[model samples]
Target chain A: MDFSSKLLENAVYEMSQLPGIGKRTALRLVLHLLKQPKEQTERLSNALLNLRSEIKFCENCHNISDVAVCEICANPKRDRSLVCVVEDIRDVMAIENTSQYKGLYHVLGGKISPMEGIGPQDLTIGSLVDKARKGEVKEFIFALSSTMEGDTTNFYIYKQLKGLDINTSTIARGIAVGDELEYADEVTLGRSILNRIPFEGSLKAN
Target chain B: MDFSSKLLENAVYEMSQLPGIGKRTALRLVLHLLKQPKEQTERLSNALLNLRSEIKFCENCHNISDVAVCEICANPKRDRSLVCVVEDIRDVMAIENTSQYKGLYHVLGGKISPMEGIGPQDLTIGSLVDKARKGEVKEFIFALSSTMEGDTTNFYIYKQLKGLDINTSTIARGIAVGDELEYADEVTLGRSILNRIPFEGSLKAN
Candidate 1:
C-alpha cells in the first residue's frame, strides 16, 4: 500500500525513469523484487553497478563492444568498401542480426533535426566525410530512420559529398511512411536493405 | 555493424538482464543512453545505486518504509484490530490507492504452491498467527489470490487458527477467476473487499 520507505520508493522512481514504464509499473517491479530471493536482487544490483564499469564503444564503428574494434569491424571477410550509415549503434545491431549486410558501418550519432536543435556539427559527419575522402569505400549507404529529420540528414550528407567519386544510396521506399526501421520485422528490413536505390545524380553513366 | 568496446558491451548486457528484454532491446537501450546527455545517465545511475541504501521494510507490517514502522502500521487512527493478509506489498499499495480500508495489513511473502516448491513454512505465516494469538485483534482478512496455491495457503492458515476466538475471513469471490488482485481495477477490487464473507466457525461463541 503506502511505500514511505526510501529504498522501495527509490527503486520505483529509478524504474519509472525507463522508457515506456510508468509509476504503477515501477511499483509492480519493486513488489516483484521484494517477493524474489535475495540472490536475484543481489544479481540485479550487481548487474546495474557493473554495467558502466565493463563495457565500451567500438572505436571504429561506435557500436557497443568489449574490445576496441568490435567483431563486425574486425572481420576481414566482410566487405569494407560498402559502408552503411546509421543513426546509432542500435541500427547496427538490427542490420547485423539478419546477416544480410556484410559491409561496414558509420554511426551518425543522430539525424539533423533543427527543431530539436541538433545540427551537422553535433553528428559524426566529419568522420564519414574523411572516410569517404580516403577513396577506399566504393559506396555510402544511408540506413537512417524514415522520419522528416532523417530525410533532412540524408540531403545534408548528400550535399556534403558533391564531388566525391563514391556511390551514394538510401534504403528503398518499400518501407512504409512513418514506420520505424527498428520496429520493422527482420524480413522487411532485410528486403529493404537488399533493394536499395542510388541517389539521383550519383548513378554514373556506364 | 561491429561493436567493440567494453563500456558499450557492459551496458547492453545489463539492459538485457531485465525481464522481457533481449540482446536487441538491450542494444537499443544502450544506444538510447549514448544519445542522451551525460547528466541524464548520471542521474539514472545515482538513483539505481541508492535504491538499496535508501529504504527498507517496515519492522511491524513488512511494507516498504523509510522508518522502523510503515505509515499505515504506525498510524493511531487506523483499525489495529482488523489486519488484512495479502501475498505481497503490491496488494497493500493497490488497497491504499482506493482511500478505503482503514485497517492495517500483513504481507505473507507469497502463497503455498507445491508445484513451485513453495509451502506454508516458506511464507510469513508464523508471525501472522502470533499477531492473532495476542487477543488484541478482532478479525483476520485473507486477501490472497484465488488460485489453487492461494486456496491452499488460506486453508493452511485457517487450520492453524482453529482455536482462536478472532473472526477469520477472506476477500470476496466477486473477483474474477485467474485475476491478480494487484492488476484488478480499483473499483472491482474495492467492491470485493466490501462484500467479504466471514470464515465458518471462526468467531463461534467466544
Candidate 2:
C-alpha cells in the first residue's frame, strides 16, 4: 500500500518484519502507536533495544537469564542428576508452571527442522552431548514436541548418550482435559490407549 | 507466565500493551526476536523511535506528512473548492486509493463518540468550519462513517457552517461490490433501493 509519510512507512515495514504480523496489522499497530504518547513508544523501543543488547543466557542450561547461571540451574534444591531437555526457554517455563517436575532443564534452542534449514548443528546439541559425557547426569528427559523434527532431535540426542549410562525418556501425550473424546486425533487416541497409565497413577493427580 | 530473564519480561510486557496482543503472543514475538540477530531488533527499535519523534502531519488536511503541507493539499490540480471531510488520515488514504474523488480532504481526526468521550471540539472540526466560513469552499462532502458518531460529527460541522452558501452531501451507502443480495441487511437494502442511481451512471464505472 502507498504511504503518505516515509516515516510511517518505515515504521510499518520494520513492524511487519516480525513473525505473524502482516502489512495491514503492522500499519494498524504503527497508527495506534502514533496516537499514543511519545513516552509510550520510547518505553517500548528502549525495552526492545535493551533486551537485545544486554540479554544473557544461563551458562549451564542455555536458558535465558540475567546472570551467568539461571535461577533454576543455580538452585541447590533442583535435581542436578535429572535434566529435562526442551526446545526453548518457553518450554522450561511451561514445565516449571506444572509444579510436578523437580529436575533442571537443558534448552535446545530449537528442534531439528531441515525444512526450515535448521539442523541438529544449528542448535546446542553438541553441548548437550558434552554434558551427557560428563557423567553428571543419570537421566535425560526428552520434553520436546511430538512433531517429526522434535522426534529427530530427541533421537539424535539419545544416540549421543548411548555410550554413556544415562537413561532417556519423553513426556507423555494424550487428549487434553475438558476435550471431547471424539475430537481427539487417531494417533493420539491410539497412543493414549497403548501407553495407558495405571488407574491408581491417574488417581494420584487429583 | 514467569520469565527467567527480566529483559525478556520487560520487552514482552511492553509488546503486550499494544492493542490485540496478549501475553502469550507477546512472549512468542519476544522469543522470536531473541532468536534473530541483534541487528534486526535494533533496526525495529530505531524505526519506531524515529517515527514517533520525527513524524509530521499536514497543516491543512491533518493527514500524516513529511512536510508542512500534505501532497494532496500542495498539489494545484486538486479541486480545492470541494472538500471531503473525513474521520482520520486512514480515510484519506482509503479515498485516495479509489482514485474517483479529485477533491481535497479535511481530516477530523475522529468522530463524535460520546461513549469514548470524544466530541467535535476534540477534533479538527473548527478548522473545517473556519475553511467553510472563508467562502472559498463551494462544497463540503461529509465522507465520515455511517455510524451514529460519524453522523453526529457531520451534523455538528454542518451546523457550524450554517449561512455559508455551500452544498453539503455524503457518500452513498449500498451493498458492497460482488456481495450477495441475500446477505444484504434490511436497512442497507432499503437505502440502496431508495437512493438507486440511474442505469447509465452505474454503467459508467465499467
Best candidate, TM-score: 2
| Model 1, span B1-206: residue lDDT tens | 34455555555665566666687766766666555565556656665555545556777777667787888898999999999999877788788887868999988878998887988888888988898888988998999887778888989999999999989898755667678888988877888788765776436513
Candidate 1 regions exceeding 4 Å error are A37-56, A75-78, A172-206, B1-10, B42-46, B53-55, B173-206
TM-score for all models, in order of appearance: 0.77, 0.97
DockQ of each: 0.34, 0.89
| Cand. 2 TM to true fold | 0.97
Question: Which 10 consecutive positions of candidate 2 chain B have the poorest summed lDDT?
Answer: B86-95
Q: Top model by lDDT, which number?
A: 2
Per-residue C-alpha lDDT of model 2 across residues A1-206, encoded as one tens digit per residue: 88889998899999999999999899899999998999999999999999998989898999999899999998999999999999898899898998999989999999998899998888998999899888899999999999899999988888877878889999888988888999899999999989999999999986
Residues B133-183 of candidate 2 have per-residue lDDT tens digits of 888889989998898888888888888888889899999999989999999
**What TM-score would you give candidate 1 relative to the actual structure?**
0.77
Clashes of 1: 21
Winning model by DockQ: 2
